[model samples]
Target: MASSMLKSAGEIQNLIFSQNQKLTHLARCGRIDEAVKLFESMPARNAVSWNCMISGLAKNGRVADARHLFDRMASKNLISWNTMIAGYSHNNRVLEASQLFDEMPKRDSYSWTLMISCYSRNGELERARWLFDSMPGVKTPVCYNAMIAGYAKNGMFQDAIVLLTEMPVSARNMVSWNSVLAGYTQNQEMVQGLKFFGEMQEKDVVSWNLMVEGFLQVGDLESAWSFFRATPCPNVASWVTMLNGFSKSGNIDEARRLFDEMPERNLVAWNAMISGYVQFLQIEEAYRLFGEMSERNSVTWTTMINGYIRIGKLEKARELLDSMPFKNVVAQTAMLTGYVQCMRMEEAVELFEKISTKDDFCWNAMISGYAHCGRMDKAVELYKRMPTKSLFSLNTIIAGHAQQGEMHKALEVFKQMRERNTVTWNSIISGLTQNGFYCDSIKHFVLLRNEGRKPDPCTYACGLAACAYLAALQVGKQLHLLLVKSGHVNDLFAGNALINMYARCGRISSAKQAFDEMASVDLISWNTLITGYALNGFGRETISLFKEMEVNGFRPDDITFVGVLSACSHAGLIDEGLKYFDSMSRDHSVERVAEHYACVVDLLGRAGRLEEAYKLVTEMPIKVNAGVWGALLGACRMHGNPDIAKFAAEKLFVIEPQKTSNYVLLSNVHADARRWEDVDRVRSLLKEIGIQKQPGCSWIDIKKKVCSFVSDDPMQPGATEVGFVLEMLCAHIRNTEIMPWSSLLDCG
Candidate 1:
């Protein structure tokens, strides 16, 4: 054919057709420059020729050059204008695209679509909506699909659903239906998403894939598998979603079986399996799968690197990272994040500097690393230098400040944040509670509710802790009801928090009821219940529960021992206290900390064994903290042993020099022993140091109002009537011969 064509000039004209075809091929392959050279070298050009070259240039992101070539065209068509507008929109030059959209001489449905897609992709929903509503002629389904997709992508599930429902039957297609379903799933409304899926008239492969993914997102593996089995021709996405779901749900065996049985596997499928093994800390399985991968992408290498990092094999992670053929930003970010998680901030920072192109995630990793390491100054310094800040960065900085007890700085960062998430509210509330600002924590919790940020288990746990510490029973019960209504009571963490609140409020029965109602109980649940019982002076019940804990295959932890020892000490069960204290390391393998020693010392002191308590404090292998000596001093006061009281008080002053309670307890001990001279000496020492004792106070919640009474409190409303009633109660108690009322009458 080439020989015959060479023999005739007419046949040689076929070179024009061949050359145009070459130009189209180059443009399609994203070689726009080559296409331009070919187009320029063409001996002649036609309208189809110019349109092909212009489309190639615009699609390849050469918008400016595409526009220049478009202007050079002697005659322009609607396709030319649409190409230019779409080029600008796709490149994120929305203003240029909008200007071109307004300037188009004759617009088609495709022309409107180009503009709508631009606004939708850019999250300019209002502009997209206006364009949709003001479309010059009848709207196309593609136009509606683009707008619905944008709403779904932006997490506006309700808006997307409204538009889907309002759409004409002619315009509602599979893509539109899938977009709404995906929107619900993305927003975590899995139940609604599933319901919508059930109502779909027709389901395609994409629809089935979305259903599988939606069920996986909600941790409903049985439903996810049901969809997976129903899929007519499962694509790579279908298999990968199920694999990932199984892995996340801790069904690693099922994930592996599906991975091995997949008819065809993509890079993402391989990564999902590797990630699943890593998530469960099955490093050996992950390693085997990594070696077996027929082909590997950057994700495969990075996944293994992260797997090693998660298992504390940082050296292995570094080795794999160094061996990577192409270290992309994602791989680098994974390693940086691994180092940050391991508390290796110095190494993370070193790697961060080595990254040639730093993304927001890289900067966030460095900031979060410094924050976790307790270097807030460095975190703030790096945060200020970030060229652009995301909500994640802002949240990390806020959490960093909260961790350091800098509530002011945390609040400042929070106020600066353009967006606040559940984590942001959690950080503030939890920080306030941890730093002993219970009322402030509760106040922020209310603000969180008012702001419409739904509280998760962590938020409710923090709020409940504040209630427990503040003894805000009314507020605590309200939150408890919220938990019950929200079904958060089924969560072990929230249930434990409920027990803690009830116990701290002296409602031991309520605490026990919560403990009994839990469907599943962890060691924390057992410890919380035990601690609550001990706090409310149910010593025998506390001991009985501890026995039950051991029988239930739950080993005692440090907190458990603290509660048990306190129960024994308060109830004068000296022998039981000694046995548990000695058995801490032997029976439970929990090494005794300072609090444990303090409990035992207090136990002995409260049992009238002053000499034994002092000897134990002096001879303990661990350092005697002020708490241990403080216990001994209080015991000396109880038993009227001024000599030992003086010794313990001296140790207390040195250990905690400014502790006013040390001096006061010593003075009280001397007064109990009728040693006026020693009491005077202690009082003079307190005056010399300019120390003042904080007055003890009590509070009661009456009709949801907390009324506080301090020593010698100023007369409040109805004080005279309350005093008269109290006097009558004291007289009745005295008349009734109640033994404990004598001390109360003497105080009145």
Candidate 2:
């Protein structure tokens, strides 16, 4: 009976050992569900089986499941504790790993190293170093290597080198040497990297690959190729690096030559070559290579699909997507982005719904597509449905509403956001400025500073623009000082904005000063100052500046001509204005739009050549717009030409029937000519149209605050004080002496 019982026990022991081995293999292969089933059904379990399951679950991104299995282990050993710590480390749960490390009854080198590595990977290098120093016994090479890698990864080259020098001889291996070398190369310090590479007595293919990659990254292709050729035995990775370098630099022919000459090609090399072609819009070559490949992974299929999408062959892209053996979220997202680029939102939506698992990127892409197409309602609906809201998504939504002129919606979204970055603040400030809420834009800019968010160049530019519209010179100067302090005074965008602000505030000289001080100037700079001179009635200076602008080799755009012709109009230089207008098409090749034509009409009208101006209006090549007719009517009102005024008004009525100024100008023209019946008719038509005239409004900055006043509206703050000041000024002007021009000339 004893012998029979011993025989059955031996069989049972063999069965358990075989089952443990099978479970370990299955877990390592990433068949987590099958491994779980097998684990649960095991007739008897051991430590190896349990540890294998935990490791497998963690490696497959099921950390919670691994922890649950860990807590239920019947008898835990050193290896079991180490494996659980490794699981937390691998999954980036540093806090959990550290907590578990502290709870360990007995710790080993592996446990300490795992905790250190977890901190290093998550950018908590200080904690990593602390754990490394506090390790109980003599450190192993693996532990030393982990600490050195953490230093190298975070750009602490000095610390990594010092640690390498202090490492014991047994621990000072190729990995340690390579870690320091990679630090220099990855940070673009190739000179130091090359110096270090030469110092090493032993170099591997990885070391050579780092040098080649470093050169390629900095756009030094010639140097990269030189290093590549000097490599004693270049691996597939070496050849692939050269291929990618040449292809990215628009030298595809060389890449192909190198590719064909490669002794052995891996799947990575093939994918790299294919991606290079796609990047340069050489889709046909990419497709040909895709066909020639005998082996392909998911990357290969996705690359081809993206290639078709890049060339706008969406149908082909979809065909490949459907043909993919296994569709991942990345491939599907690429197709969705393609549809969004083409504004095919419906197709994008359909594919978006088909994605079985949606990531943050997938959600943002769909929301961006809807927002870009001005479908905010749909975007918001999807945003509400998003499982996790990221900062980028919130910024996208805010920017979308602001772009579509939905300020209230944008502000509502902005206020609802619990956290914001510089981009978030910039979006709202820029939106408010663009939508003509200048005061509010500046107010937000101030609030941004008070909140301790340093404004970028764009924010400063937006603030300057608001000051320009409000003619708030004091506030503009303050922003300029702040911009200079921020070290962005030489920024092209900010400099141009400063010029515009000074110009609009009737400070033409200050505008010129800002322009002259700029380190560099583009066409917009020249145009801005020229327009400033014209708007301020400095006609001679405007003409001189235009000639100087051309002499500086800056080609004049249509906007330049607007400033030039407007200068001539304001200065009553009719002939010069006509000459410039004619030269627009002949000399400059600039097509004359309605604004140009309007300038010419104003030129003639101001010079009392109404007949000539009227003829030009009838004969201009481009169709006349409201601006052109408005210019004619204003001129008629100045010269009391009722007939031309009537003609201009009739056209204005058809083009902009509800414009209050057009009606007002026509009525003024009739009244100036003592044509009461005509005036009455125009006024009657204005009343019939039921177009309430927009009240004339103006703004002035008082003690750094922008105050607005509407004509004949008395509800503004400090209205009584303002009225008192205005009455006193008018009375003083009436009581002052008036001198004749002849007397003034005698006095001069």
Write one digit per residue (lDDT tens) for candidate 2, span 428-516.
Answer: 99999999999899888888887867788899999999989988887787788788877678778999999999999999999999999
lDDT of 1 at 567: 93
Tens digits of per-residue lDDT for model 1, 1-748: 7876454655446766788789888776545556777899887777668888877776765666778888899888887788778777867778889998888888999988888889998888999999889998888899999999889877788888899988899889999998888877765567888888889898888999988888777667898899999999999999998998888888999999999899999888988988998899999988998998887876788889888988889989999989976566677888999899888877888899998656667889899999998999999899899875656788888889888889899988777777688988898889899989998888887778778566888888998999899887767777887788765677788899999999998888988899899877899999999998888888899999999999999989999999999999888889999999999999789988878888888898888887888788888888888778788888888888999889988988888879887888898888888899999999999889888787777779999999876766556666677678979999897677332222311222
User: TM-score of each candidate?
Assistant: 0.75, 0.65
User: What TM-score does model 1 achieve against the real structure?
Assistant: 0.75
Clashes of 2: 0
**Model 1 off-target regions past 4 Å?**
1-132, 135-162, 183-196, 205-233, 341-344, 483-495, 512-521, 547-553, 573-576, 615-619, 694-748
Candidate 1, residue 310: CA error in Å?
2.6
